[model samples]
Target: MLRLGNPRRRIGIGLMAMTFVLSIFAGRLIQLQGLDSKVYAAKAAEQRVQEERLPARRGSITDVKGHELALTLEAREIFVDPSEIPDDRRDQVATILAKELNATKQTILAKLADRTSRYQQIAAAADPAAAQRIMAHDLKGVGSKHRYRRDYPGGDLAGTLLGFVGTDGTGLAGLESTYDRLLAGRDGKQIIETGRQGQRIPMTHSTLLAPIEGRDVRLTIDRDVQWAAQKVIADQVEATGSRTGSVIVMDVRTGQVVAMANAPELDLGNWMAAAGADRVNRSVTDVFEPGSTNKVITAAAALESGAVRPETPFTVPDQIRCADQVLKDSHPHPVERLTFSGVVATSSNVGTILATQRIGDEKLHSMLQRFGFGTRPGTGLPGEEAGLLPDWKDWSGSQRCTIAYGQGVSVTALQTASVYQTIANGGVRVTPQVVAGTTGENGAFTASPPAKRTRVISERTAREVSAMLEAAVSEGGTGNLASIDGYRVAGKTGTAMRYDTRCQGYCGYTATFVGFAPADKPRLVVLAVLQDPQEGHYGGEIAAPVFKKVMTFALKSGKIPPTGTRPSPVRIRAGE
Candidate 1:
């Protein structure tokens, strides 16, 4: 429809347009391939490569006989990448995850709402089957990682002693916390290249370091004995409606703790659900007045210092005056002549005070320290409290006499048990030990060092105290309930006013009975303590029976036959 121009000129214009366009494309390609190559590659690498942690296997906790108490099992940690989940599909994916993984839908939805985060942990220690179910849905951004979960095979047995682990697999309490370094080992890591969907890119995985597995911790606790002790103490606590209770059984010669049981046991599998107070290992942590259980120490001091003999007589009455407090025997009685052994047999608070006057406060204080009072029992468990032992110089006027009768001084169940263990071991105090040995990652077994020993009294003094304790368990004595038919038993009963912080003073009673078997040749010492019992609060009434039950079991289990000799008659009445 128009006049034609020069054909060569039209062709040249078209060629010019095409050349400009190609030139611009070529420049851009060169810029991308050369000048900005490293920058783009770095950005791509940032999106494709990810660091992953390889969890180390936590060690096993076994009892003396190689019975596993706590262990680690393989598990999965489910996670989600909010960036990969579409806004419209987030609710659907969250719903699937909540149902399959047993997680809260609201929690999963909250994590899915954060589109900026590439990784959000949805659940830890998740069951492999649950993780598999989650993956079956092919929900975008949902994934899982290999993890190690801590499990207590015994459930609540020795739960507080074995302690618990945190979500990150770190020890949080008890022996687990005390020996975390040995049990946690070393965690390793790996770097891998991933695809757009966060899938592992084959042949691009590299482990930066290999994980080191934790070493096994072997404890001196006997699994069967522990179970028995726990059963008995837990039963007693329930029957008495006690606020708390504890039992300690020690190998007299070795100071190795056979069983340390507490009531309302901490169930390791559900440790988080337990209250903080219930989580404590009260045997070593809680402190209480020893009550009459401390009388044995007074007897030891008096016998050791040559201030009194088992036959020495004291004129005792219902009550005596000391400082501003009137010290009295547990029960009211008229003035009566009681021999030194008789005073112990009756658990006479007044007689003990009169006898304590002979050695004086300083000597008694020294004796308490020698018996491991006011010191850590060295059981190697976490939260071990050195019982409160005030220096004699700091004693209030009333404290002097009260402490003499086992009221002012505070001692832990372990410390009280150690006192009788000293007597049972013939006056030599062995440091209490919980851990027996350790098995290394390389499968090497190493035994714990020998327990430290100290002589608190002469063998003769220990024997004298032992005889007095035997008298205390004799017929018509305070702890007569602790007597066994076949074997001679020696022990003391204690009923002290419990100190309560909430009350800011004494509130309830702490009943205790500590004793050993085969009076002639003591082998094992068992101590049972009950705090704030609603029923009977007398050691002989409630606590002594527990001691007898545990001791009978331990004696029969250890096959320790009696000395085959009748207990020597100690005159309980002065006129006799």
Candidate 2:
């Protein structure tokens, strides 16, 4: 104490300085250990572990006959850590991958030579078969991740109807888009250990999460029937020099759309680049004036409302005055007296107009609505259009009369087919079923319950209308070619004039034939429409044979035996 004059002061100052130093050190410790612990730990973990994505398998789509229409196959995606390859072996690895993965050699070499990158995509959606060949060589810096690639077994058969998926395994159109959620399963993940050199550690313990495979989709489409319908429609369109065509084979009893086919189809493999015009599901999406095919609806309305009977006679004329406009038959001839049934059999525009005059527009529109017109068929397909049925209030005098003969109203091909189905099913308008149901991983299927049916007309009226349609396909009738040799056929011929886009006048024509086979004991109802045939414009000539071809296939495919009854003779005289 004597040696240092301010010993107490020196001790007090030293203690205070030590306390300040300790306080600063404590603050730094708290900041690093408590406040930023997670941040540092995350940084360390990110560097130590490698994240790999595990893709899930998409579901399969099969036909009603269990034929595989679409499915997903195990595919391999080649990825690489460029730094792991020896300089001399880079070219060798690239060559092997190029040959197996259908990739350019130069592209694969560039990825292999980049020593700075730890990850690079060499090939995506590679075929498992080819990937196996590559892995057999055991090349360095190369690895594969399993994924699912979409496969269409029925190539271009029902291409437009099945639709396709995107690069990331997402559905883009048709039934794929309609039920994508059910088909795309959940993805999994993997966490792997890595060395300080930024390379995966060999035999290191890692965490993994399992993936869930997607559920399957079962469609009502019959592969055999769909193939036959497509071939028949395609051949007919080419033979008639028509622009395009579609055919729908529906079960009258269940409204199950067995086969829906369209021509001018787009490519299913690369749908994104396909022509927009040809990509439509035309059977359910394209609308057109149904021509005389709609006359059956008018017949039902007349019979149900007691406006006329099948035997009721009307004066037949080549042309009749409908308000200020004159309506004429497709083929010009002298006026022939025909009964109401005869009017339908010949598809007489004047007779149909006269019949509509008795029922009036209000009654006629009600009947059309009841027969599943002016609305979508609820088939769960993408881009479906509810056919245009203008309100009676908006209908002009000409519109009212023209609609009776299947003009002034538009209908999609499905709606047109359903109208015949309604009459064929004893006047019960059963909603068409398309999707059927979805099958889960356990193989248990959850069905889409069918929509309730509504009665459109009385059974007696339906029977009379069916008989009238039968007469139309008889000898000397418009759709005579639609008749099978043994089975009784009932259908109508339609050759509606197409409206010019510029509204100048009618230019092109839409030929159509709608009918059902085994009319005595109905089974299948077929509708065929040919748009703007360059050769002939009559539905009887251009469209009826297509119906016959398709109907013959349907009856044979269904194993339906010949119904001995023949089509009733056509009545030419009105008073009979």
Candidate 3:
């Protein structure tokens, strides 16, 4: 009886199974169409919609006269969607991409073979033309996306000051790093439709959020002057075989840095091409015992205190013993008397010590503070050193005597220039500035105010010191080599043996020259420093010529009229 009923029962069971399947399908349709419509809609939107990042263009950086220094160019990033590639063409696609992207064949194959990953970057920062070529092949999985690249049009000119950006589109050094927030713009996002192959669907519904462009930056550097200074310093460093060198040119009126050049120099476009030392802005960062260049501060202190006059004479000595230390000139001479101006012109350490003795420690320290020593120059650049000026209490007998002639105390090239600038700008101490202004995304520009000046000495004292500085360029003076053909130059040459901490004695020498032009109407202050010269160790021999070349070009570039009376070029005696 069971065998006879089997066929009919099986047919009934099959029909019941078909009904159950149809009922379940209808319930799913109701849920999708009504009960879970909102949730499904959201899921559909998420699948169909693609959010793309829109990066804003970074701002351009220009010189004071609007010459472009750093700018951005449109570029592209090439990538591959591994899942989109057909299995049959995978090897061919991987080979072509590997060669073009400079990637290993194994790397490309591994990326393409990764079924778990939907997208993979093949090459970041590909040039537009190269990216176009790659996209023209129209490989199944390969694609390109728009991006930005930083360009330095000026190349190595002002490279140390302008700095460069990293691969991640972030600033790495210099002004770029200092003003990163202002230069980097906000990134926007947009929702766009995508195809099944992971490519953006053309002309699909898109919700765009516009990105805000970054603000522009204008610097106080003059490209021409910067180039000239860099050239001169580089040439000088090579010629002298100097271990390192730096040059700085600053505007006397506004305290704006006109040119800052260091050798070795770096090319911002290829930062890794140069050594780490070449990337250093020694003018602002490195400090050394300035030698006789610091006599300006001692002279200023004496002048401000009314303790000495330009004509005031001091009992000069060939050697003076302070504590257990014996201080002598570069060469020993008999005890001689000299005027205050003569003291600076000859760079006599004894005379400076005698003058400082009259001004005392407190007055001299106050004057040094006003000259911007022992503190950061406030240049707003990273790694700006405040320089080393030990407190007055830290000054012992030997320290005080040595500091008078620019020994013991340390200062950067910028601080030395500022000291001359203070005298040049009628004894007003102004804060040095590099940035001229910043332009906002809204097309409004905010300019930096004129440097704040505080009167540190009487106008009469500045003029008096100016006259004494002029005397230093006269016949038989240490810095006579700094005099240019058409300009009356006032400056001092400094040669101090660098104290080797490891050796606990003087090792090499740092040669320096600090001066300003057109002694009657000072316009520019230039400071040049050469660290550890091999050929010639004297500041007058190693550093003064560089200053002459730079100051001559800078004065001419500034359109500073010649003084009409040319001082005779002092013939420097070898080993004098």
Candidate 4:
């Protein structure tokens, strides 16, 4: 207490006080200038220099004529910085976003509750109107980014073939799914200065790398033909009260599918509302007993194996008994003798079984495989099923007979069309090609090589089978309704019983017709398949007429000239 009075002690106390104050200041200066400098500089840089990835635009899907089937357009995606949102207005902001973006209030609230997060996705690919509404409000913390939105301008035109894109910009079906790799491009990046609210600072120096667009996919589909097919099939399906229907149009020479249409189309814009089954590409995915339409394969096998000739005679009965099942005609009639050509022309189940019996199961299966049954058509469409064709070694007596007439075995519309394409192409089975190739960034097109081809039968056999098919479309044949004036048309009619899970057996019928026009030198193969029709369910009654209209339009549009002469008739002599 008396130290203040002493000179020496007072001098020492002054020095000590000076040293303590200097030490405190020096430690704070070091902390501010050295230890925490990098941390502070980084924080400053975040507000001045922002790095972000630039999204790449997805590719377009086009028809052979460069018509857009699917594409991408600039659309707004809503985002947010929860930290920038004022606490007092949080509920108000959430309510506004929920109404404009069609999002849940709870979702927006949860996002707003995270005060630490600087970024959050509020909505993806919102329409322009919604973006406009949000901008009009000019609310704080709400932001938008322009991103590519997958679009199908033709509505459901080629929905099954063009497929769809998901919210994350990935292909999910059809050709889109098949060639997704080439369609999704690489993203880029940019480093720029941003304000606290995440807006770009004006006139700030920045680095940017531009995004590359995906290659455009050019399909072999003819938009006109596709539209016609889709319209006709949808109409017929609704008229006949069928559950579902599909149509396929293909170029005979190239095995390129011109159109693949399914009824009650799956609209790409509203895909989420469509039933999963409706979105299926029935041309390749769904299998049905081909009914009498499969007779062409049997006829080809018989002719190729030299088991029978067009003039070979068969005494067809109304009902024929196999091992355990009785095979009967669609309508009952007395026994009548018909030529091998007449057997096919009439779509006679008994006569076809008799013809196939001569060919044997092994020869028949070989012919079916050669015709591209029991395998994918190699069209590049994903999820394609190799329609159920069991081996000859597993065939029972009834199975053999039923298979001969297109029952007990299943096939897709694609396989059925390929069979005719094989015959039309002179027995060489060519793989179906969906995409022609890709369009380069320079706007140059690279053509894809034609798919592999295999000779399924000799020219002589193909010609013979084709002639039999011609007679099948003749005046009195079952496919008579399929004929078009000024053109020589050849095709088969099919009406097969459908299996019912409710009863665990055959119940309803699936009608089908597959035909080509200008039969002498065919150019187009068109097929119409109808499932479970309530009225006039026979192939000839329902499917053939539709085939005629669609094929007529296709032939006209394709500029195919009519042949001057109709095909000569094949006469069947009565049994002696």
Q: Score every model by TM-score.
A: 0.92, 0.90, 0.90, 0.90
Tens digit of per-residue lDDT, candidate 1, span 1-576: 898999999999999999999999999999999999999999998888888788899999999989999999888999988998888998899888888877789988999888788889998888888888888888878889899899898999998888998988889999999999999999999888988876789988555888999999999999988999999999999999999999999999999999999998999988999999989899998888899999988899899889899999999998998878787788898998999999998999899989998998899999999998888998767789897899999988878778876888888999999999999999999999999999876799999999999999999999988998999998868999999979999999999999999899889999999999888888899999999999999999999999999999999888899888988889988987
Name model 4 segments beyond 4 Å from true.
1-49, 87-117, 127-138, 199-205, 500-503, 573-576
TM-score of 4: 0.90
lDDT string, candidate 2, 192-243, tens digits? 9898655788898788998788888888889999999999999988988888
- Kindly report which residue stretches of model 2 are placed more than 4 angstroms away from their true locations once superposed: 1-37, 82-91, 106-117, 196-206, 500-505, 566-570
Model 4 per-residue lDDT at 75: 86
Better of 1 and 3 by TM-score: 1
Candidate 2 vs candidate 3: the TM-score winner is 3
lDDT of each: 0.91, 0.87, 0.85, 0.88
Q: What is the C-alpha RMSD of each candidate to the true structure, in Å?
A: 2.8, 5.1, 3.8, 3.1
- Residue-level lDDT of model 4, residues 1-576, one tens digit each, is 553488888889999999999999999889988999898899899668988878898889899899988998988889888988899999999999999988899989999999989889898898878988997898888888778799899999989778888888888887778888788888889999987657788998999999888889999999999999999999999999998899999999999999889997889889888888877798889889999999899998898888899988889998899999899988898998999998988889998988888989999988888887888888768779889889999999899899988997888899899899999999988898888889787768889997899998899888888888888888878999999988899899999999877778888899999999789989999999999899888999999988998998888888999877768668654453
Candidate 1, 49: how far from true, in Å? 2.1
Candidate 4, residue 250: CA error in Å?
0.6
Q: Which predicted model would earn the best lDDT?
A: 1
Alpha carbon lDDT at 385, candidate 3: 94
Candidate 4 collision pairs:
none
**Residue-by-residue lDDT tens digits, candidate 3, 380-454:** 887899888888888998997888888888888898898889999999988899999999667788898777888
Span of 10 residues, lowest total lDDT, candidate 1 = 198-207
Worst 10 residues of 3 by lDDT: 567-576
The C-alpha stretches of model 1 lying farther than 4 A from their native spots are 1-39, 83-96, 136-140, 202-205
What ranking of all candidate models by lDDT puts the best one first? 1, 4, 2, 3
